[model samples]
Target: MTEQVVTGGGRRGASSAVERVVATVREGVKTGRYVPGQRLVEADLMRELGVGRNALREALSRLRSDGFVQIEAHRGASIRRLTREDVAQLYELREVLEGLAARLAAQRIGETDHRQRLVAALESMHEVARTAELPAYMDENIRFHRTIVELSAHPRLEELVDQLQIQTFRIQFRSAAANHDRTGMREYSVTEHQSLAEAILDGDGTRAEDLMRRHLRHTRSGIMQLPDGDFA
Candidate 1:
């Protein structure tokens, strides 16, 4: 009985270690610490994450399932790089999902403290935009969208949006980095974000949806215009 108990505890500990590795790797990819197509050395990951080979492999497997990593037969694991077609397809889905999230948030704006929170998020975006720091602006930009998703009060919708956002994180970061010098584009994005916030605050579901779709469409256009080398 004691052996069984110990075995169970070991399993839980291993699971926790795998989770830590997974979260760290995911955050690394999102923050650009791990760029697309970069090889992931198992020995390095094991050392850095302080996990054993088995736990590291398990974490990599989970990441692979989530479309964050790719394990080629002989090439080992590497960050998954999105192709041009992949970006286009992801944007197409994002438009629908995010638009729906915006509409739902607008419809439910008065049901909770979402109003205050959303206003705060928009203000944060404005403040970050003034700094002209790409990383801060990107962080606030993601926060603003996440606030709207939370306001939607739909668990499944939030989960779906979160997954899609994670998958596109690298692409979005790269696109933004490439256009970091385009001050006009940054200003325009902030303006559109304000317009989106207004629509949601006013509880105009239809307008909120329309604006969200339009915002994503413009972003997609900009990403498409990037040099061919940007995509796989």
Candidate 2:
């Protein structure tokens, strides 16, 4: 009985450790501490995340599957970086998927609180953008998009978009960084997001879809303008 209990406890401990390491590493990526193409040293990550080597390794393996990290023999792990083609291809898919998501969400959003949630998220983003809080603005921007996806009421669509969003997060950060006039950029974002929220709220599916496509196109243009070396 004691041996069985010990084995179960060990499994639970490892599970918890894996969860912790995953969350820590994901947050680090989102917050830009682990920038695109940055090498991840196992020893430093183990110390930082307070996990054993085995658990940390397992967590890094999961991140690799999630497309946030790449692992290779001899080189270990590093954050995944995007090429110009990657940016183009990703945005192309996002425009289609996100536009469809918006249309579906406009049709189904009344079934839940997602509409109000989207409005609140946009308001929060506007407030933070005014203050020049890029991180907070990005957080709210993510929340706003997530709410729209949730309102689509399509599990498979949500899953796919979630994965894409994770991969494109660094691109979004770089796009924001490339802006020379942050105040103007923030104002533009607020205006665009407000219009998006309004279209969804009105249940104008066609308009919502078009607006979403336009918004994504604008972002794609900005990302493409970034120099090649910016990705690294």
Number of clashes in every candidate structure? 0, 0
Off by over 4 Å in 1: 1-4
lDDT of 1 at 209: 99
TM-score of each: 0.92, 0.85
List clashing residue pairs in candidate 2.
none
Lowest summed lDDT window (length 10), candidate 2: 131-140
**Tens-digit lDDT string for candidate 2 (1-232):** 9998999999999999999988777877877778888899999878877889999889889988877888989999998887788778888888899999999988986885876777777777777787757767777777788888888999999977877776777778778877989778878987888898889989999999999999989988888888878764
lDDT of 1 at 206: 99
**Residue-by-residue lDDT tens digits, candidate 1, 1-232:** 9988999899999999999999988888878899989999998988888999999999999999887899999899999988899889888998999999999999999986989999999988888898757877887888789899999999998978877787786677678888856578788999999999999999999999999999999988888988888888
lDDT, candidate 2, at 67: 75
- Candidate 1's C-alpha lDDT? 0.89
> How close to the true structure is residue 187 of candidate 2, measured as C-alpha lDDT?
84
How close to the true structure is residue 75 of candidate 1, measured as C-alpha lDDT? 93
